[model samples]
Target chain A: MKHMTLLAGALALSTALTGGALAQTELSLWYHGAGNAVEREILVGIIDDFNSSQSDWKVVLEEFPQAAYNDSVVAAAVAGNLPDIIDVDGPVMPNWAWAGYMQPLQLSEGALDGFLPGAIGKYNDEVYSVGLWDAAIAMYARKSVLEKHDIRIPTLDQPWTKEEFDEILVKLKDSGEFDYALDLGMADQSEWYPYAFGPFLWSFGGDMVDRSSYTTAEGALNGDAALEFGDWWQSLFTRDLVPGTSQDMADRETGFIDGKYALQWNGNWFGIKTLEAVGDDLLFLPAPDFGNGPKIGAASWQFGVSATSDHPDGASAFIGFAIQDKYLAAFSDGIGLIPATAEAAAMTKSYAPGGPLEVFFGLSEAQAMLRPVTPGYVVEALEFRKALSDIANGADVADALDAATDAINADIARNNNYAPAN
Target chain B: MAAVAPTNQRLKTSLRYLLLVLVGAVFIFPIIFMVVSSLKPDGQLLRDTASIRAFLPVGDISLDNYFAAFKRAPVGLFVFNSLLVTGITVIGSLFLCSMAAFAFAFLEFKGKEIVLSLIIATLIIPFETIAVPMLMVVNSLPSIGPDGLTWGWLNSYQVQIVPFLADALTIFLFVQYFRDLPKELIEAARLDGARWFQVYSLVIVPISGPVFATAAILKFLAMYNQYLWPLMVTQSEQFRPVMVGLQYFFQLNTAWGEVMAYLSLITLPVLAFYLFLQRAFIASIASTGIKG
Candidate 1:
């Protein structure tokens, strides 16, 4: 069956190629990094460089802004017109891989051993995708703002308990310099929820779903620890620690920049963008774990090759070059991410300027957890996050969680409940 | 003349001028603010109100924002694509829709009422409902060639242009105008032994200037502002249109100043077109004061 499917895919791809009027060997690559013109220019330069550097294949770079990238991807897939290469958020990788929309990588000798272990995953012992880079959510504070309150910087490695976090909020409130002590964002969970709340749920040792055999314990939505985490989060809004308005996401970061909020939870990506927007008065700290669980922000993105690709070897080779020690260092230098490869990460740490790169690179091993890499994670995580929002808005934490749990389990069951064979 | 006193006329003119100035200020203030905001630095964006001095840039006012914006993506390519698509849409819609309207209005075709009813029926169904199937048709076009395996047709102007060739609303607009047109004129043309095509091309088209102008204006604006279909069909930035390009600009919310500048630039052409067509467009719309 696998052989027949492979042959069919090959036939379809060939027909798509020669079916065109042109005789050129065109490879379609879809990307979602066109949000900024600067970023778009960078992407275009990469495609142009690749085209100029190779003779046998011409890479056509297609981009949609991140907001519409996924819809476009799925639509393209439904039409049997999936791109030859795709760069997607890591959470969606498993679903696409499981649905047979993406092809697994068959590494050349020593290629499998080169990347960090946790960065790769296998289903049925076949590696599906590789992490291009690592991203994590952490707490950010303004140095001057903290100094105004005479508060010493909290050690990130140490997980602050619930009581301690509340105390810091009280201190900031009493200090009278800011309107809010901490910005516990609930407004736009689309971007901030995965990074901010995912870690919070994990800090209490809660999993969003139970896939124990797959190493994802499914009860994160229904469990007591998750409920406690929700209650504590709700208190932030209920007690007026964070605004309840829809503008909370952008408002929180801007407030922190304008000295309105003392502490904010955002990922390392925000760190670099913030630095560019408002210079380096920002300091990073690990999300408070409270000792019950480890602080783990959600992973950001990974690069993968298409299963239907004609030049898988070349694609893998290009990924290697894109994340090589010097290239990784240069690419992630201002981007606020730890390099996925150990050698690249260490080199970045040793040479990263002004010490902020060290702050990000240091968190790789300190206290972090990955978002569940399961086939139903995207559907499960979104519904699960929406349940969190309802809880934060004073809905019954347990009931809201139960519904999310049911929704996730239903999705998992619908995806054929694949039990990975050892 | 006896009933209209000079005093009353003077008062009326004053009231008209007053209303005009008030409405003008209402419309112009936001544009003024946008221009000012584009000139301001990043920090002043959320400041609610910026000083007039903020607009001058004082060694800080640079074309850097616009330059950075243009450099960020293929703005030039998008502009060309947009011009090509929208320009063709304007011409196609004006000619084809007007012809169809002339048929519905004057020609005694079979099932004329039924045909008109069916055409109007399409307008009732929302475009969103049919967008999915329409998109499938678009994607499958390249595969419809003789060999049944090609993709060249999917991304070209044909895919973009064909689905939107005959809009129901445009046909409706032309039909309404043609119904109001003098039937005597058509009879006179026929009496001169002119064929139906000659009558429409020469007589009807010449006399129906205002209606055609209105249809052209409306079609140009709709196609110019279209974003979603092009975004789906176009594979690469090399063929992306201007609306998609502007959407990408706004997506980078981190760079507000540049977004504002790019927005200002994108709106300029639309504004210029509106200005050029204002007189003709107004006459065309106003001519519809008495319905058929």
Candidate 2:
């Protein structure tokens, strides 16, 4: 009788343990930082913490290369095998949401209260994604070069006007001290074309598409302001103030630091490296005020729940946990992006006050503009890129802008304006 | 006159050799550049591209890129995955395609020509055209595994291998090679009371080395270099092949030296495979006039 009671107790204990293990649901996450060691490590740490923090869910991660991530997601969506969690580019979240690949994120009421505006992704008035960090662009110049040329160094509050900026470029070019006055990274023909140059259009009092309707690019793209922007843009290439579209990628990578160019418009991701190379001379200045205001492209990768996920609440819980200030600071320090929140920035090595890239956080906060927040923005961006490239290569600015407007309108029409009802 | 003729002949031979060497260099330059650049740092590698120094090992050279490449990704695992997939598929395809080819080449059956024609007709349909439909089919298909019967073959080795086992190009190559063989061998084997299977095993397959080599190499290359299909199917890195692994090196700031290093590592298997079968591949090409 004693042995029988012991056997029953042991069996009961084993069953209880097994039942507890089986009770935890598994959630799969797809991330686009497969080869980035720092990103992978930080993300893996977050997943481990999330899994251990709750008994209701266990998250599993699968990473894809950044270059191939979008295509892989689309393919998985078609196969109906999307994971429970997916990290999406902030600008691209609307397209994926519209295509029914991603659903709106679920977070606590004050979870994103202090997050940068660019780090919060919304489509159709519903929050779809949230990021740990954001990226900003600035004019990279050498303090020594600017001082030698008697060029006024632009600040967040007091930026160079259009005439002043143009005169600086001309002066720098005429000095014959550098191969080119500026490196716009024209050789990077990918998303950089639209992301880097679209801000110039905005600063010129034009936009990629009219934000009022988010449906057309008619006056917004080819109007008088845009035409002026386009002409000034083309003159940069025609006058040889900047390298043309045929610029070598190697030259673009090394130009400003190698002293081949006086100024380079680049992202904060390159800030630390340039700082290291040029030491105290490297300056990350605000974008010159063209006319209306200084502007820069915003948004980076963010986490969202997939539409196909059976456990969205669990996925949202993971995302909410990941957005903690510590994780945000870790990501910023690891990848050189501006932390999403000021609190996170204060904790980061670079984005903290008086840090090497401290100004970038302010730049992102003040000057960053999200790309057109609509599914049609994808096609619009491509058209804008082509028009800009054509104009830079000496095409008629008016004709190129007109063609881009027509193409964007055609895409909008083809997709039935990507209306929310559909 | 005789002295002049000999001298002219020597001059012609010398010019021919010179042209051949130049053409060879043109073909080999990119490979040399990849290997040499793999040994240099990214800065020197980019700087050297404008000169012939790109193809020369004359810089601050180290195997740092190779080490970094390994650290960034599972280089060995990717190579192993690709090799395993390619090897199994090539072997399976050779067997199945050759057996099918034997039926079309030797056997008399109803609608045999029609069947062969239909199989050949599929060659015109590009894989991209059918990829979506094929994905759907594979997703719905059933498989029995250690976990018992399961629907959807997604994220499995069989998904990569099974759909590619009976390709049209391999079948056509085997059929063409089989048709050219004399009918006397089959007749003699039959006269000696050998079954059709016996004839296939003893007579046809034993002598069909060139076609086997040709098909194996062609299929090996195809399976090894697959990018889109595997990318679409295998979501897990455990099953990702080298081509998909190549994307891992293309980060925001692409490490060019590491890219070259990764490429150099993945390319070793292909080079070794070709070298091992070069004699048979050449003989097959010379006889059959087929280009792989």
Candidate 3:
């Protein structure tokens, strides 16, 4: 009789444990790192930890490739099938939020403190997303090449002025040591145009759209500063200081490393590989100052709660849990990106102080600026890409800029300036 | 003089053969490059692209990229899903569109011409224009499965198959072929006291092998290359097809070797399907003057 009583007690305990597990609500997360094995492993680890650490919420993960992720999310929104949580590109968060596909995040106050400015996705005075890592672009050069050419190494505070940079490119091209003085990765005709070249425009006091109004791209895109930037961008091709739009993609990948190009403008993701190839001679220098100041594109992917989610709190809890310094460090270590927080950077081997990729952290801290923060930036970016491409192919600078401005303005008018659905 | 004429004919034949070989090589060069590049590393592949070496597996050749590609995505699952979805849709499309074409070609009814014209008119409407509204329609559709009635078919095989079961192109192909099928054959069958369905099954279908092959191959290619619909409808990785899976290799620093490897892998099924139906498909186009 005593033994039977003990077995009954054990059964009751087991049932209570299973009941507790059943009580946890399932939160589906849509991630955009499907094919990246490291990201998948780290993300799955985080999900596992989060699921085990709490009893109120259990997170499930579904990953989509980055190329198709945004479209999938939009389609899901149309079908009313969006998951509870989503990871969106930081620049695209505003558009998604304005479209009612995503909602402003509700995290604990001060949770985002000390995070990089470019890592937080803010729209209309609300936080829509937060990223664990940010990426920064640098003018990749070999120290030996710069020293051999008797060129002064530029710093963040005193980057090369517009005339000095242009003169250097001409001198390098005239030396006949390189096929082109610089490889701007013109072969990459996608977001690289706006992400990499947009900074050059901004450095000239021009922008894709007027950030102040968020309604029109008028004076910002077609202004005198932009036309000057366009002219300079075109001159690079005409003067043969840089490869044209028809540049071979393979040359862009190997030109600098193979000694066929004097400089390359690339991001930190390629830093580790180049560093391994060039050793200590590799330099990740600041973008040349084109009168306004040195600048580069910023922001990477970030997490947000879907607008259709029935449990925003649960999704927010998972996002908040994901932003832990350890996970941020793991992601930075797995993929070479600037960790969002200094604390997280210290934990990462690549982004830590005195590390090989440490300069990128400083670069991100000093010069990383967000792209235009309005929903209309989606149109403005593509337009900027087209204008830049045409200018590279020798299109009239003013005409290209004017055409881009007109298209952006017309799109804004069509969407009622992308007014909030709310 | 007769011997000289025969020699001249031989010379012309040799020239024609040489020209044909050159054209064939031009068409086959990219495939050779893709397969060759897939065997090499990224650095070697990029470097080799500048020279004829790209088409030659001359250096450090291995199946490492194939292995790495499998690690990046469920390549087997994607190919299986694509095959399954494509197989069902092709077979169903051929059946349903052929039946509809038979009725339009033979059976007379009120507004029959208008209906057939309307069906053909849909050929000009791009799938992209209707993709969203059709997505919403499918999202609200009721589905039956082991779980009993479910509301949405968003992440299922049926979602990919059913909507594409009767596209305008396939219907048009069948209608054109059916219209030209010696009308006497259908008349004789009808005079023999055959029902409309019987005429379709015994008389039309048996003689429609070439068109069936033509329609099957064209529809197979279209369904196999499905990217946008599957991407939008199926969020789950398990239901993703090979084209969507191709995006797996397109990271920021794309693994070109793996991309080539994946492309080569996926092309096998297409080539096999085409080769399997090559004879009949050629015969169909020869008779119909319709280049699918």
Instruction: Pull out the clashing pairs in model 3.
Output: none
Error of 3 at B223 (Å): 0.1
Worst 10 residues of 3 chain B by lDDT: B166-175
The per-candidate TM-score of the B chain, in the order shown, comes to 0.87, 0.97, 0.97
The models' CA-based lDDT, in order, is 0.69, 0.93, 0.93
Give me candidate 3's interface root-mean-square deviation.
0.6
Query: What is candidate 2's TM-score against the reference?
Result: 0.94
What overall lDDT, based on C-alpha atoms, would model 2 receive against the true structure? 0.93
| Chain A TM-score across all models, in listed order | 0.83, 0.97, 0.98
Model 3 DockQ class: high
What DockQ does each prediction reach against the true complex?
A: 0.24, 0.67, 0.84
The CAPRI category of model 1 is acceptable
Q: Give the alpha carbon lDDT tens digit for every residue of A1-422 in model 2.
A: 99999999999999998888789999999999999999999999999999888789999999998888998999889889999999999888999999999988889898899899999998888899999999999999999999998999888999899999999999999999999999999999988988999999999999888889978999999999999999999999999999988899888888888899999999999898889889999999999899999999999999999999999999999999999999999999998999999999999999889999999999999899999998888888899999999999999999999999999988888888887655
**Interface RMSD (one decimal) of model 1:** 3.0
| Poorest lDDT segment (10 consecutive residues) of candidate 1 chain A | A349-358
